[model samples]
Target: MRAIFFDETDAQAVVARLRADGFEAALERERLAGEDDDEDHPWAVVSDAPAFMLEVLVDTHDGWLDEGDDDAGEHTTPLAPLDLPTAPRTVKRPDLG
Candidate 1:
């Protein structure tokens, strides 16, 4: 699943942690604050692992998974493309048969 993390620290820490945890992760800076080049920049990541993730946000630090404590189970799937704001776009049918 695609996850967006907003924090004041460089995403390298989290990226490294995720990699160590055997996840396919990457860190990319956001261009919103014109401080992307700095070590402390806002970043996002897309990971295939469904395990819990730790992040230090501007307000607090914590680790959490999409699934709750119930532990029914969690699965990762591709993110759907967002539709345009001005139109109701059609979802292409896939050849699943």
Candidate 2:
């Protein structure tokens, strides 16, 4: 289960509450692409809590909850190739005469 909150404080508070209730909850900060400011980022709550409990908690806090696969909403991008030397090179020593 997962939820997103626009406020960090609220997210943390929820996480605390869930922990107090014996739920395995974790908080994370998410910043989407093209968002340059830290204030624009949102906080996320991930938990192994049941649907009923999650629903109640989210409803009580007026938060948006997204229930789906654990990896849902995660973005993946391909890595670019880099050009570099694959073998060691030897350098000749200069005479000091």
Candidate 3:
């Protein structure tokens, strides 16, 4: 998932635009960890900073979308996992067989 930060003011507009353009976009209003809400959280999930910021989460697969059915607001398909690159780690090699 990619989080593209945009100016707070245009967050909603951007999200709407992306949705219209057949892209996966959403406004993150709260932290899922159940922590105390901080001042950083935008009241409307949109910012009013110098510029509007948007977090664009690209779909890893077409499955994330609802099979392209024409039903409005009918999200039946499950959200697919985002493609992520494997972390790089060094492993010591033992004696070869």
- Which numbered prediction scores highest in lDDT against the true structure? 2
TM, every model: 0.38, 0.63, 0.29
Model 2 C-alpha lDDT per residue in residues 1-85, reported as the tens digit of each score: 7888887878888899889999899998876679999988888899988878878877877788886565753655546888889
Q: TM-score-based ranking, best first?
A: 2, 1, 3
Candidate 1's residue-wise lDDT over 1-97, tens digit each? 4344556243465666668889887766545555655655446655655544443321133322233332233445547898668867778768853
Candidate 2 regions exceeding 4 Å error are 70-97
lDDT of 3 by residue, 1-97 (tens): 2233324545465566657656566666434355575645442232222121232221211111122243434557667899886997777778752
Q: Mark the regions of model 1 whose C-alpha exceeds 4 Å error after superposition.
A: 6-10, 31-41, 54-97
Error of 3 at 62 (Å): 29
Weakest lDDT window of 10 consecutive positions for candidate 2 = 69-78
Can you give the lDDT of residue 97 in candidate 2?
A: 32
Per-residue lDDT value at 81 in model 2:
86
Instruction: Give each model's whole-structure lDDT.
Output: 0.52, 0.82, 0.41
For model 1, what is the C-alpha lDDT against the true structure? 0.52
* TM-score for candidate 1: 0.38
